[model samples]
Target: MERLKKLMVGLILLCLFISCSQKNNKSDGKLKVVTTTTMLTDLVKTIGGDKVVVTGLMGEGIDPHLYRASAGDVDKLSKADVIIYGGLHLEGKMAEIFEKLPELGKQVLNVGESLDKSKIHFIQENTPDPHVWFNTDLWETEAKAVTKKLSEMDVKNSGYYNQNYEKYKKELERLGEYITNRIKEIPKNSRVLVTAHDAFGYYGEKFGLEVKAIQGVSTDSETGTKNILELANFIVQRNIKAIFVESSVPKKSIEALQEAVKSKGSEVKIGGELYSDSLGDKEHNTDTYIKMVKANTDVIVDALK
Candidate 1:
């Protein structure tokens, strides 16, 4: 019933946003942009350049799957000239908030909405995986979408956005190649990625690894003791040397699996922390999206090798 109420409220908000009587009259100096994740915030800042001011709701080590907007966050959204987010329920709890923004005349855009529906991988019948940024090529698509949207918003700086997009595209192409070649260093059978949650489905599909997670697509999904014991059994049977913990997810999940492995007289190590829903801290190399992928790849390859 509560979920039904939320959906109904979202529907009403969508109607208001699409055909609402109110809207911002014109550009008031620089466009004030608010984003849901650090990746979107970074991309907009990179492409929007000097044309906009960006605010990101979630930071490094924060889980978007578990994040809820505070009253202050609501105030920030209310004042935003443009709102952006990684859609496809990446900001799952904030669906109604996004629905209401469009009605308020804010330019709200979801990064995932730009992708062709057929191309996105569906984990469970019709449930599209929202972690598109894991695959660099797909992430490039999001980057291009940001470029086009920024161009439309700040026509004067369209050229700048295009230039930045071109440069970033080349860099992404290189990053994709880097991940591909680096992955080759590991033998095929060892190319399995086990993490706390199934966030790496897109990464595995694109980069050629079999992914396993105790939790479902969302971190909020219920994980049972049976599932954990079964996954631990699979790891021991397959002789997978290491499983990983996610930066955003609780380590206890993976730790439980490790304990299960030990109960069967087998040993498995926690590979290393992988960035699932969040980026690494500023002092580390994974402060940026591209760098984060590289960091994860290195950890994965090193552990598996």
Candidate 2:
């Protein structure tokens, strides 16, 4: 009878251990998520909160247009439960690899791909400008798409994701209104936003500012002498006071424009650097998307107001 009792106790303990292991596996063994850019990682964190482990392939200040994923990156992505990328060909060399990853049964989400087809303007063959984050209104839509995808993948935490997403979406909407109101402070004629590249078309379009670029839509586009001359002439003719440089692009382009204007007896200052391709350093005010827009707003307001 004593031996039987001991055996029964051991069986009960084993069953309890198995049940505990199963419960833990169901709750928090870590749901691995991989994002193509730091921007997406920020959005994912806003939705996933601490329930998911998120990693960004591109670091802060890194331009997504020229990024080449390493072998280690491939291995990391291969292990993810979901792979989220900006798509719209923003990944450049990694585009094909991302498209094919879904074959491995990973949930590959192209957040920008969910945009309304009519609202998209293609910058290249089968590629829409991946800089959709410029328009806070548009970005709120994308954030909702991200929340839906993440919730679908990890339904156990759906409520948490939905709540966080709602909060973030409200913040994004407030940011949009803030920009619209602050930009109104600048004289209507002074609303010209000139930058190294044409990244701000959406921002300008959304906020009622005139956007000009020394380079084409992509920073990868080489600035031609004709383009520089024309931009300088426009600045001189319009009496545009400030030309902005982007943090990720070379300042030489903007400097050249400044010199061109100066040679023609017109003065145009470099309106503080804007966070164009990527957000500013992790410690800076432009670290988060909201902070980034505010930093850019402050610079634009001070320069153009």
Candidate 3:
């Protein structure tokens, strides 16, 4: 009954938005792109440059996994020239809405879904991890995909988009090198990353860290007492120097794990907040994708070293 009611409300909003968009068909002569996560927003802005006006539905510290599209979000999406999102169920609650957008004639790009299946990491037999941005190589591929989409949509500005992508690609290469070097500062055994959730699996695999978490990939997943206890024991057994809290996930689970560590006669520090599912704001110097990843690397290296 609840799902039906929500669906009805969405349909009504979609109709109203479509009507309003048709009535006010004023063009700024730029492609209006709607992105689901801040990461994608930054990517589009970096590649699209002055050619696209990008609006991000999820802002800094917003968890995409638990994010549901509001009426305003639906309206924004309905009016977009193109909609791009991190697929692989990253935006768990908004999956249905994304599916319906293409049916409404909206050009939609599922960045994660466009990747080669072999490159994606599967946490379970069939469930692939959605946090591909952590792997710089994979993120470079996603950036290329975005460039291709923007060029296809705005052929006149294809050259401009390609140029921006080439420049940004070099920046990403530098960022990858920086991450690899910074991660090496930590001793091999001490390179273990303990976090509130399993969002850093890609980061761990990419940079050679062993990652453990009290919760699963999605923040919507529950954290049981047993899970917390087990993670705490692992931390104690490994003598991990520091654990991390995610910008979008609650700190309580990590805090509880800290208490469990204490009960087991070991201590662990909350290293620093890592930008897992979202980026930090400008005030924190992590507004851009490169800055966010660099800031996270600095935090991790500083804490674990």
lDDT of every model, 2 decimals: 0.85, 0.82, 0.89
Error at 191, model 2, angstroms: 0.4
Reference-based TM-score of each model: 0.91, 0.89, 0.95
Candidates in descending TM-score order: 3, 1, 2
- Which order, best to worst by lDDT? 3, 1, 2
lDDT of 1 at 21: 47
Can you tell me which runs of candidate 3 are displaced by over 4 Å? 5-17, 20-26
Q: Write the per-residue lDDT of candidate 2 for residues 209-248, one digit (tens) a residue.
A: 9999988766777889889999999999999989898988
Instruction: Name the regions of candidate 2 deviating beyond 4 angstroms.
Output: 1-28, 124-127
Write down the worst ten-residue block by lDDT for model 3: 17-26
> What local lDDT does model 1 show for residue 137?
82
Per-residue CA lDDT of model 3 for 90-207, tens digit only, reads 9988777777766666789999866899988887987778999999889999999999999999999999999999999999999999999999999998999999989888899998
Give every collision pair in model 3: none
In terms of lDDT, the best-performing candidate is: 3
